[model samples]
Target chain A: MDVSNLGLIDFHAAYAIQERLVAQVASGEAPETLLLLEHPPVYTIGSGGSEANVLDPAISVVRTNRGGDVTWHGPGQLVGYPVIDLGRRGRDLHRYLRFLEELSIRVAGEFGVAARRVPGKTGIWTDRGKLASIGVGVRRWVAMHGFALNVAPDLEPFARINPCGMAGCPVTSLAREADAEPTVAEVAARVECLFPHLLNELLPCETETEGGRHVCCRLQVARGKAPLDVR
Target chain B: MATEITMPKLSDTMTEGRLISWKKGVGEQVNRGDIIAEVETDKANMELEAFTSGVLLETRVTPGELVPVGTVIGIVGAAGEAVAAAPVAVVPEPAVTETAAAAETAPAPAPEEPPPVHLSVAGEEAVKASPAVRRLARELGIDLQTVQGTGPDGRVLQEDLERLGGAGVTVAEPAAQPAVAETAPVAGTEPAAPRTELHDALPLSRMRSAIAQNVSTSWRTTPHFSVTVEIVMDAAAEVVRELREGGTPVSYNDLIVKACAMALFRFPQLNNSFAGDGIRMNADVNIGVAVGLPEGLLIPVVRECQRLSLREIAAESRRLAERARTGSISQQEISGGTFTISNLGMYGVDEFASIILPPQAAILAVGAVADRPVVRDGSVVAAKTMRATLSADHRIVDGLYVAQFLGEVKRLLENPVLMLV
Candidate 1:
């Protein structure tokens, strides 16, 4: 995976760059690349999001072609836009979402914040609140608009609207939960460092057995650290 | 053979998605890679593309209708294939579709839905009281039907019984009393109070109890400390004037909210909750503006202040304040506040600290902005000023951090234009 650290950038500018990279990766012209950066304070609603969930009418919201409700992006939050060709890996949006969630869980763990997925909810959460949000857009099986992890940004912006369309949703950051205050840049570096291992372990699971019967796959990371297998 | 098109799972959590619109109409020629329809998942909308070149034969779903993943939304086949051609092989099991439709269309289970009307055995209106309240009424020798309930839907409360004490109701002294304690009240036990006179014993309203419960919880659980700052609001006043003249009608309080949001963005620690062993940092900057109603206090949150401009904040604050004063504020409107700003400036107060709302780390109490003499560069000069006090959780943040956060707010307010970015 190729990694580029683009510090704080505008949402549209980064999105344009992502579309270009997505096209390149889709056509096999470029390697899978990760653009790690933060956005200047803005609220973005995906194609699946409703404007009704945005309670405050004064704030300008950008609607994008991504799956999910309204979400806020701004400084101090690490946004990882991975341009990867899922066509070659597996054209499985479900598996891709899980891959992103697992990657975020591992990254939060690196910062000493234990994060995991809640049943029926898409994102990484802790006892305190939601830590990372994953909303991906796939064009030609190339995924973009990946995930946003709260690092040390002001959470007050999330209050203006229901985060991810769930009212009274509590959004937390690594700096709030971890003993060590990790900057957005530091968290982005951690993601860049840890994503490859997580991708390898989570992406290649077979959804079917030798008998051709469909079986659910589970990642047993709790039993031991070294042994990883599909079950 | 007709190729079946099923709804795709665009996001991991999407079990169902709404069929937005059909880009290719039924019976239209569709080529491979052509956009077929638009589907809206819970989080986003995606364009479903045709995988096989064929004529659109039939559409099983309509626009704006939600269908489950793996349900055949449409079908494509040879141009001669009629729409009436049976596609039974591709149709989902009747039971599956029925259950999915039921789940999608059914209203959320309302626990508060009034109970089914029971046929009265004796044709008498049923008294609305809990079994426990009925049991207590039996012990207190009070007739429940005669008692005016203060609870929701006119249900009787325990406090209502205590208020009946001065009303000549006889108290049963025996521990083992018969269930027939529905005895008549003794005459001349106590003289009835004058109905026309002012009554001193006022029952606590539900709002009052709620306020008491919240403040008590915060007082007990949170270890709080306060920091006070005197802001020179000269530039902020000018900005307010310019905006009002420009028809924006922003107040000094709105300027304070924007400034505080910017400051909170820089000082994330102040926007965190002390969760015993660790601090829980909030994601959005929701600042609650305290609205003083005649009944009690209502802190309607001004959400996402970090993303809102001064004019926007002013409009939102004004709307919320209006709703609060009119008693039309909703539970959603007043909930989910990360920090609070309580201004008593209109009341002509100089400065006063406030209690931190629970689960939130801080609250800013603002005094009236008035003309005051201040020392600047060695000489006393008259400047418009305001004093703000921030009460914060000491467990989550120290005095130094609170002081610095307040200092940032002071800086933004003093400069005024610095908060625009």
Candidate 2:
């Protein structure tokens, strides 16, 4: 699997870029691309989520076509967008979410964050607070939008919306947990390292890339784009 | 005398709305302000008011179709009025003036061959359940057709699903062989005959599924820690007894709800929900009173509980509880609750923890109010007391906040007169 990592930026710019990429993927133009970015303090509602959960209407609330309820996103948060053909990678949304959650938990563990999955939720949480949020939109079995891990985000904006329909869970950041702020880029690199192991475990065909240092998998193809090769 | 019924704009941002369903069909006599149709706006679903008191002449928009605001959805007129002669026109393009003149002057073209009536077999004979139940079922991954509905017309009810047995059946059925083996008696020398079951296995009802999903989700996702507080309800019981003797029967649950509501005013954070990122302090103090019905528990909210007096809370709660029990509550009553209170006092429960309702940070579980010996002013006295527990999602509420919130509830309940003022 070919894994691509992007940088953090404002929510609208990131959303626009993701939207453009989605359109291309939907139009059968661009290869399946996983664009990672961050938002600058915003709340987004999922397909069937209620606006009532959004307590502060003055803040930006972007209505998204994702599965799950409303959640918050902001700067210092590592948001990963996996634009993969679910058909090519075994159309299992639950499996995909589990993998992302596992990866986040692993990443949080690297920093001694002690992150784990809440018994019935789809996100990763630390003993103190929620470390990451997950919401995805799958179009024609192709997945887009992904998890947002609080790296060093100012959690004040989370108060504006009911994150993932859980009204009162306080958002936490890796920086807050570590008691020292680490740039999202540094966290993202650490997270990217776990991707290879996750890809090999999740996908069937695995291969070594970059002088056998990293493992990768070439997913089966259907019609639109090249199979995702994650390393 | 055709009275055109256009879709009224429910919200400021609503340019177009989808007609969910028409409660009253064509030719149905409707009074003014009756909910003839349900419209889904951008923000929420709202009822379409029937401003005209007359017979519904015709329906212009089908359910589930989106139409612009002010679109002529239907027309009303006196019985026997020829409303069919009225010109049909879209809201933006009003062709009625010219079309009406043309119709009056020119003989109507022989009605084009009557179109074939296409009836949906899928819709006909399909199960009839409330939308909330269906939504709950879909979330819980339960098949509605399986549940044996006990509601009117065999409608699978939310309460029915909320029942402990109902949820146990759905949750345990997947591993039924193991469950049965564990619970059943050991086989004798002669293999025990399979338990005779008269009923067929049914799918989980939507409400049951939702309850399962929510309860399991809350338990699994949040690191829930509960703190119990014992309130000396001697004052509260006296107030209730006095009220009842004065011809105003009020429940202890009503007093608890009022006390909690008042406590929330002091600790607004308790009125919040866990929005994964942070706490969202709700603006309204709508209190969801958890009512135990045959199926399960339903928390019908008593909106603005802080504003209403104890008497008002009792009256409104009684009404809502009755409506919920009868399954006649309007959609409005079931939604928009900011906080919830669950009472198992009547069930003789000393104390029990409750799952936090999503979006709300905490839920107050009221145990039975009973007579207990307590030390008051250096003397042991038998006093009426009730045990209550507050379950808080650690992510949103800290230990101190929970303690403070519970303390306030204790103060208000101990001094019932303060709540009245």
Candidate 3:
């Protein structure tokens, strides 16, 4: 996994860059790339999401191809764009999802946010409010458009939309919880460090790539090395 | 006669469903129960079955399209029967055009001359554009609506908004404007801060909102009281061991479900639902086993549990659980339950209470069965015991009734062989 740290940018511009990058990887034009970005404050609706949940029409709403309903993104938020080749790592979306949740929980603890996964919900949430949101899109076994962690950005924008299609659950920021403002760059670095360990733990040891420098790795089952033999 | 295939409510909270795929295209013959399309609800992906056997005349919406609860997605009618001319298209045009004309004339006055002045504010005074283009430009925060379009009559379709970098337009008021924060003046000479709009506003997802409503209503409407009982599972555990030794594997939940079912036979009123006018005792003991799904909890009923054997109950529970996890359980599988059970035993929870499912007067919550030291015959002894709580709606059943009901359950669970009989 190649990590590129991008500072805060406009939501539309970030999405445009993501589309180009995903297309490039799909055409084998670029090696798997993960572009980390923070947005200027916007609400997005996924493929099956409804615009009706957006209470404020003034805010820009971008409909994207992902698996969840409506979610908010804005300044003071840390958004990770993971463009890794899952084919190189076993194509287990479930395990990948679990890794994402674990990474969020770990990063949240550093800021004393006390985040945990809601039993059936896919994101990390606190008792009073949600701290982070996760929605992903995969193409050709490569993942893109990952989780968003609320840092210091004004969460007032979240009130305008039913965040993640869930109502009554207020969105919270780390700054609000920690009572200290933290830059997006600071949070992204912590997240990048936390994700690789989780990825390695879930993937088989043989699947680890060369030198473990590049996170993308694939393993072919050896005859005797099979964990279990049916015969 | 033409039969309109409206969007069916796939779940209790689903008011609309997205057509994932049209399995049967237009002009194809379809029989009753034939899956014409796959509808993705908030909770799961469900197959839309044809309720009437006929030729699929027309598909109103394509795959990836969504329609409201009463919106017709397809038309089914006899062969050679002329389907009703897509009624939706005919209905919306006249009304929509009328409203569009009214909106154009009404809102044009207040912001009529402000566009030119607004264009100058953003440093783009030379641009000239139509009202529609101006509206799009304003929405994209673009002031370049003055750029001339090459389309017939210079009409803007969505691309023009994208081409302008979505900048330089001061036209219509922003739709769904965020609440503007009032900024205090830093100094007497300094201008007040620009009205900063905060937060992304969105509509509530029907499913999530419904869940909230149901939970709150359950707490408010039901005067619920819970009773916890510890069942010494030495006999039940031995019974399970013997059964496993005989090549029959069963879970503790299987025994609990069976025990609850057998106990319901003794106190039939406990196996009843609160009808609007009066209490309705169920003829059969159909127990709903709650299974947690990826999106939420779904309880699939094991119908006629009183007639099924332990092995049969185990098989049914396993089948229902697999179906719930795979998102393939039918509507009937979730409907028609007289009682429900939720288990947190695997999580090592020693005791917990559950909310009563609507219409069903009570629910049983099972916790971990563990070995604990207890005073047996006035001496301390390590005994295997499981804690179970029964939450009942007090409006429908009294404390004495619930006590008696719990007693019957305790007897059946303590005497494990009684369940088999």
Candidate 4:
């Protein structure tokens, strides 16, 4: 899978980028891609989710065609949109979503965060609360609209929503558990760094990685230092 | 009327703070200047005070919960007010102000009609796992509906797939010879069934989790550079042997600690930490000796290493490590380390660099000291020597400074009398 760090893009622009990349990858023009970026204060509702899930009446949102409930995304949150072609991997959508959640759980494990799957739930959770939300859309076996991890965001935007239509639990981030607050870029670097190895172990696409099982590429995601460019 | 008292943001970066303890309880008279509760922020523990003079109506937050600032943690209003359904006053986040401003320009678009849902019937009932799990099952050709779940509410955990090949009867039934050889183990001739009966998931202990998190964060964030040097331990070993013979029972580790203390005194710059904001040079020379345990490694720090003699350092080191191994070492016993020395000498490790512990600028990874043939003064002789690698955070200690510090340590270890004196 190709990973690109699109740091700090607006919601509309990122959505447009995903749309463009999804079409490209679906048609075999562009490589199967994972776009990592952060959007400004915005609430999003999937096709079937209720707008009422956006608790704050004034909260602005952009409707998208993805599977899940309403959720908020902002700065300090790492949003990964993987336009992966599952034609050769597997045609099952649930398995693909599980891979995304497992990938997230493994990354959180690196940070000493015990991120787990809540059995019937479709996201990642910690002892404190929900740590991540996974919602995706597919086109002819090409998956897009990936997962979002709360890194060190203001978290106030989360308070304005029920957080993926879940209730009675708080939303937590890595910074809250971390001794020193981590920046969005630092987390993005780790996600890009660890995701490949995890994908290799958890779900290896034989045609993609060749003989190399370990994706040990370390990235420095500070503005200009990161391997992947921010667009 | 009961007014909700919410969690207050103590700092700019603090999105949430844990309620350490409540100074007052329900129905207690809370006045201005009254420290109603103590909240622990990322930086420090702060006092949460009451602004209005009223009775503590209710405590919405319990101790140890890290809630967002302005969450309705308590109610401070009139006496006996019916707070049956306490209104959870949502603490407006600073980011919400930006969202609200954006709302005016683009008012929330009216609720759109729900899109048409497409439910796939392919393996619908058989797909009894999360999206990630189902895909892996399909890839491995293991049916999920056949696998027993170990997760909450009979949910198929990620680990259930491990037993899919053996325990799963239906999936493996069609694979040529069937699972008949696996089921009808011919009287102790089954090679003990490969010890793969049950699938188990081991949860991480708190200490293990802490070690993983701290080291991972440090390794990722810190820019480290290591310098290795071979130091002759003939003199230090003689001193240690002499001490053990004298009934003090000191080890090479104690001598190294003392030598490090003296070396740090000589080169104070290497003892400083790279705090990201600025370099902090520690006043007292405290050396943390890394003690390996089953759970993980614990570094118990020796305070005032400069004042303690060889015997005292040895005694204290033994006491602390013994306590740590026996699970008696408290947090205070293991904290506040300036520099660390990790010895893999006992394990026969030759020489390896280690990750620099966070907030501490440098750490010394000590290797085994044994009889090795070496060229001494041009002639090869069997000499007792130990190799050490010092990994220093480049953000704090300069290469020249670390080299000088390591040089001094080598000199002190070689002489062995200067530090003791």
Cα lDDT computed for each candidate against the true fold: 0.73, 0.67, 0.67, 0.69
lDDT of 2 at B96: 31
Which of 3 and 4 is the better model by lDDT?
4
- Scored by Cα lDDT, where does model 4 land? 0.69
Per-model TM against the reference: 0.45, 0.41, 0.40, 0.40
Chain B alone: TM-score in each candidate? 0.54, 0.55, 0.56, 0.58
Best by lDDT: 1
TM-score of chain A of each: 0.88, 0.80, 0.82, 0.85
What is each candidate's fraction of native interface contacts (fnat)?
0.29, 0.00, 0.00, 0.00
Expressed as tens digits, the lDDT of each residue in A1-231 for candidate 3 is 567877878777877877788767757788666677877666787766667678788877787756567888877788987776554554445455555777787888887777765434667777567888877765544566778888888877778887877655578878877756777888888887766555555543233322332433442223233121000
Highest DockQ, which number?
A: 1
For TM-score, candidate 1 versus 4, the one ahead is 1
**For candidate 2 chain B, which ten residues in a row score worst on lDDT?**
B110-119
lDDT of 2 by residue, A117-151 (tens): 65346688765678888877654445677788899
Best by TM-score: 1
Cα lDDT of model 4 by residue, A11-122, tens digit: 8898888889877986879977889999877788765566767777777777776766788888888999887766545354455666777778877777778776643466
Compose the digit string of candidate 4's lDDT tens values, residues B188-274: 755664432211223345476567667987899889999999999999989888878988888999988998899899888777776
Candidate 1 wrong stretches, greater than 4 Å: A205-231, B8-21, B25-29, B38-47, B55-58, B77-81, B85-421
User: Candidate 1 on B294-325: residue-level lDDT in tens?
Assistant: 88989999988889998899899999999999
For each predicted model, how many residue pairs clash, with residues at least 3 apart or on different chains?
19, 36, 34, 7
In candidate 2, position B382 carries an lDDT of 96
DockQ of 4: 0.02
